[model samples]
Target: MAPRNKEQEAEVLSWIFEVLGEKVPSGQYEDILKDGIVLCKLINKIAPGSVKKIQERGTNFQLMENVQRFQAAIKKYGVPEEEIFQTADLFERRNIPQVTLCLYCLGRITQKHPEYTGPGLGPKMADKNERTFTEEQLRAHEGELNLQMGFNKGASQSGHGGFGNSRHM
Candidate 1:
């Protein structure tokens, strides 16, 4: 498991509580979110009716289903698949940092929905700036080598010893 950041986890918790219109409580982050109820509530708050039925009290499998539902809803709401955390990450306490990262991504993705005017989590997401180019403009740079590719300037390792041998002056 990766090292967990207390500050980031606190921030995500605060954001979740704020979105749910509940007061932030001083408690274990994983324990608070283990049941996945808060997660479902958070996503539903962002996107109403995203999760049709949230199992309030049930077996472990039912609770895990809530996490899965939240995952699917977030993916449908534009959160990237790679950014979403697995059920075990939150439930089994496998990787809390990943869970925090997933929440942060969910908060950042809220910018995609203009209707979401609630409290945000991390830095504001940048809007897409697309620039179109004409065919002539693209062809002009086809034969030209990009400077970012690095200029070797005819330098080569012709005199260098094979492998790790030291070169004597």
Candidate 2:
């Protein structure tokens, strides 16, 4: 189990509730999200119908299904596989921090969807800044040394001794 951050946990909880437009339930973070109902609802809110069936009340396996479903839905919605937390992380309370991280990542991914105008969490994602150059312009720079790389100004190592040689006084 990784070390938990109360502040980060609180922020994630607040963001989730804000997005879902619900009050934070009185309970531990893991307990509140263990059943995966809230997680399912969160993904649905971000991308409607992402989770087709949310098992509201059921046995452990069935409930874990909800977490799995949430994971799949978020993956489809653009959360990277690596960033998605395992079901046990939340359901088994093995790594609550990872679960929190997954939620934060989901919140961050929301910025990618223009239709999602709901509250956002974390720093706003930077927009893509793609620069296109003409063929001539690209060719023009082929032989030129990019100043950004470094302005060597015809530097050389003529005075420097090779490796293993000591410098003279």
Candidate 3:
């Protein structure tokens, strides 16, 4: 199916979050569980291949169609129950505490995995301020900046160089 346009997408997303925040409101519990599934799918879309990994590693999640091996593998790998249960807890439970934990863990997992490095989700950059700059690199960058701005103090003083709009008061 073709994707929804931006306005439609915004409305749907807004509805989901607003409904999820409700406490024992007019909705059915079963419907809420279905909403959780939709939310899980959206999260998977954001971090591709995550649903498969979650199935394989999310130990406490109980949807057992083709998940037998993952159940075994998760235990074998010694991944904690808490680590594995984010998706399931979000879908199956939908409690506020579980939802909070699931979102936190999902963010952590996506940040840790290399395949999730896309767009704004790229691997964290080390602070440039924390890194030591060699004098040669510093000089090169300075020269590049000067060239970028077409700046030359000596040429300017000789009155033969300018932005052509440099007015002296």
Candidate 4:
């Protein structure tokens, strides 16, 4: 496959976001991991089977095997292992930050591997909305927020648990 042109890349991103929008917490793109099956399918469409085995491994009887397969694929495919592990770790917790990290990892893959991206469509393009976050608006409570933003600071990835009454994997 050829690397996607801007138009083609945009379309693929749109489709992924559209699917994610419906499958996840409405407009919450970060919550993509909350519905791992759907996100895995979309990721597979772009990366070709990179995560298919992961969906099956998510449940009982093969957690370790599934973890290994998932780790291997991400490591081999150039995704940052830190982000991938963060996705699962956060996923088990079902918190907002985990969703954020998951989106980042998937976005990095599609952006980096344009050849594997989708071909362009005619004129029917993805929807668009615009918003701006200034330095202050985007980064309030700078000190505390920074400390709590990553995969580890807020929760332990060792088991499934959610913060405050948030969703639980």
User: How many collisions per candidate?
Assistant: 0, 0, 0, 0
Candidates 1 and 4 compared: the better one by lDDT is 1
What is candidate 1's lDDT per residue for 1-169, written digit by digit as tens? 6799999988899999999999987779998999889999999999999999999999999999999999999999999999999899989998889999999999999987899989998998887899999999989987988867986778877889898899978
CA RMSD of each candidate after superposition? 3.8, 3.1, 14.5, 20.3
> Candidate 1: misplaced stretches above 4 Å?
132-169
lDDT digits (tens) for residues 1-169 of candidate 2: 6799989999998989998999999889899999999999988988999999999898999999999999999999999999999998998888898988888899899999999999988788998999999999989978988877877788967878999998786
Runs off by more than 4 Å, candidate 3: 1-35, 46-79, 84-94, 118-169
Q: Candidate 4: global Cα-lDDT?
A: 0.50
Q: Give all TM-scores, in the order shown.
A: 0.79, 0.82, 0.30, 0.40
Best by lDDT: 1
Task: Assess candidate 1 and give its TM-score to the true structure.
Answer: 0.79
Sliding window of 10 residues with minimal summed lDDT for model 3: 65-74
Two-way lDDT contest, 1 vs 3, winner: 1
- Model 2 residue pairs with clashes: none
lDDT of 3 by residue, 1-169 (tens): 1322434333344444543443333454334433334444444454444345333223344443223333234333333466454444334543434443333344444444466443322135443366787888777865345554775654655553567767555
Give the Å shift of residue 45 in candidate 1: 0.5
How far residue 135's Cα lies from its native spot in candidate 4, in Å, is 43
Worst 10 residues of 2 by lDDT: 150-159
Each model's lDDT = 0.92, 0.91, 0.42, 0.50
Q: Relative to the unseen true structure, what is the C-alpha lDDT of residue 139 in candidate 4, on a scale of 0 to 100?
A: 71
Q: For residues 52-130, what per-residue lDDT tens digits would candidate 4 score against the true structure?
A: 5654445533444444455566566776656665444434543444334434465556555657545322333244578
